[model samples]
Target chain A: MPTLYIDLMSQPSRACYILCKKHGLPVDVQMIRLDKGEHKKPAYLQINPLGKVPFLVDGDLRLPESAAIMAYLCDKYSLPDNWHPGSSSSSGQAAAHQQQQEQQRRAVYESAVHWQHLNIRAGCMRLVFHTVIGPRVFKVPAVPQVAADGLKVLQQALKDMESYWLGGGSRPFLTGQQVSTPDLLCVCDLEQLRMMVAEPSQPQLEQLLAPHPIVRQWMAAVRAAVGPALYDEAHGKLAAAVARLAAAAAAKPAARL
Target chain B: MPTLYIDLMSQPSRACYILCKKHGLPVDVQMIRLDKGEHKKPAYLQINPLGKVPFLVDGDLRLPESAAIMAYLCDKYSLPDNWHPGSSSSSGQAAAHQQQQEQQRRAVYESAVHWQHLNIRAGCMRLVFHTVIGPRVFKVPAVPQVAADGLKVLQQALKDMESYWLGGGSRPFLTGQQVSTPDLLCVCDLEQLRMMVAEPSQPQLEQLLAPHPIVRQWMAAVRAAVGPALYDEAHGKLAAAVARLAAAAAAKPAARL
Candidate 1:
């Protein structure tokens, strides 16, 4: 079995973990605590010099980056095409026409993945780090200006998803009617907003997502496809983190000397 | 023939253009002048919606994002496997061992591409935009603080490339000894720093690159692999733009009446 080194608190790590679980691919899941800086340790760096989570080791292949890991898993396990949407026949005898069709599907899928990396994921991760994780977990001071800039990018990304990717609900998911790796990658980042609010109502996430109903619809579809059990399990650590932050915030005034 | 809408001034556009030229792929290269807002115009928006340069149209498929465009072109034209490194045999009868090796290569390639998107490409583009393009072309005021932050990112990216990706010149190219799409994508972004300095001597580019000798060496290999003639042609417009910027900067004091 391949070994997946990840922290569920990390969005991409959770995405990869859920992907494996969703497919019943038996693999060892090793948690690398980001709070303790385990990812940057020399041992982990030996395996993955990039020092990032969601590192996959299958035989001699040590792959880092969630997008690549998910892609490799899909191909290796022969997951449903809808989940990734672009695998040529292993028989190598796929007709030219069918191969062309697969190429187009693969290209569309790649476009979504690339777009997510630079836009949705970048924006959301920046915002969440500035507002929630950095302040609460790392004790890093939150810069309001940086957080504001992050919000702007996040908003633009949400708008673009509604207008371009979803095409005003014309497509059931980002690339097509089925949820793919891009959807998983993006939705996980957006889910990080759950930590943004002090209250459990998650007003911040709602407010940001309200105008982009199509994005909301797409998120619902992706969550449903991944199934509630595994999806919630994937986000369990994040939920706990958010609760801890909320509790700390609530106790601050009452405990003051 | 497929149509590639691009502006050579755009790094990814030039990368795609050069890839097609290198492979002798018959492609219709159309210019979309970003300075003139051509990419954002309704006609172009109708096709790409993402409103980015290096948009490719092959038959019914309309692909955006440079990484996707390059990958699709590589597959559609059946470019050398080393250029991409993970294409499965079309006959699909390859042994499991060979297929596994290809998957590993492809995974490594994907990791490089993903890393470039967020690290090297992001840092270089941000720095260039704030210091060079934004002030010069868009008439947007340069934000020194943002430029400083961009420089930090660019510097860290260079260091990471040297230590992690290049492994102190251990590997010839990003993924392997052979040149691939990640090399093209990253090298083009680094090339943008040429527009930063005012004098003929690109001190800014040189100074930024001086510490990371491995990255510089890898860049030389990518350029050699692409060959000078086509590579020069691909960067023609960017060179012209850089010249214009230099001329404008030189005349700034004298033009003040």
Candidate 2:
């Protein structure tokens, strides 16, 4: 059985957890509570020298980085075809199943994966690194402008995503007719970006994810593919846990929030 | 022929130019002349909404990111055999590439690509963006500290590169015995870093590319396998450039020392 070291509050970690559990991959869920600095512990640090969570340990082999890990596992397990249909990439052009075959092919989907790599992921990560992790690790205040810039990039990324995913793309998913590894990646990111703007701009995202028919269709397809219960469960894991803790805090007003 | 908009100073653009000309890919170089603000012209902006340089136009298919452009070309023209050597991935122990026969299957390469996508690439880019490009584009002062921090990450990345490139793996190359797409990607990056990083601090780098026995041996192997003259010319395009520019600058009394 592979062991997955996870900190659920971290979105990518949650992404791995959701998929692994959904696919029923043989994975041992070892909790590395990032907020509590458990990942920095000597024991955990020995596993992942970099001290990041959501790393996978199988036997003597240890793997880090979400995209690599996701790809590694998917290619390994032969999970359901929709996740990443092997034959699709083999001879692809347009979306499969009329599935807007063009949408599914080497252009829009592939470009989106590469595009978000630099723009969205980097931008979102900068926000978390500067505002959240840097302060926690280095006692430095998040440079206000840096965080602002990160959000601005996020907004533009959303615009690009909306353009491709809804505006032009025919597939219900970001890539096309079916979900690929990118969807797994985006689920984690978008959940973290509940607020598209500096504040909780869920309204803006709601429109992008729902009202935008393509995205709305894609979301439904993704939810259906991933399973609605699992999707909601994965999305709400942190929220539910946070709400629970908050309730406990309210029950005892003197307790910490 | 595809039209490529590029700025000479841009690293990715430089890489694209080198790959195209070196491989003899049919490409029409549309010099964006970034130094003169041609990239920001409305004509170029219509092609790439970002108004960023290094946009590629193949018929109506417009791609902005370098990764996207590279993938497009690689897919379009069936590239050389060694370019994207199939790697054993995702599949666990059941994965059936014979270890001995599986010449290109690599172990550490997965994390290498992962790190490139996440930490190394993003870190260096942020450093470049915030420190170098920020000042160049926005009239801000170059922040040495930011570059230094980025350099630290780059240094570690190079350290990892040295370990893996030197280490015998599935392929003698970065991914394996075969020089895959990442090898090209990595070589370009390493070459660019030679120009960017200070000389004294890059002692290991100098040694690796120089008289150092084992390291130089590995570098030679990379150049030889990747095609020495082509590699040299690809890199030399920039080196001769620096030397000539250096001589010209030295001749100018008004130039800052």
CAPRI-style grade of the A/B interface in model 2: acceptable
Report the C-alpha lDDT of model 1 over B77-118, residue by residue, as the tens digit.
888888776543444667898777777788889888988887
lDDT of each: 0.84, 0.59
Candidate whose TM-score is highest: 1
**Candidate 1 residue lDDT tens string, A182-213:** 99999999998888865333238889988988
Clash count per candidate: 7, 12
The per-model DockQ list reads 0.68, 0.29
What candidate 1 gets wrong by more than 4 Å, as runs, is: A88-90, A198-203, A250-257, B198-203, B250-257
Q: Please state the Cα-based DockQ of model 1 relative to the true two-chain complex.
A: 0.68
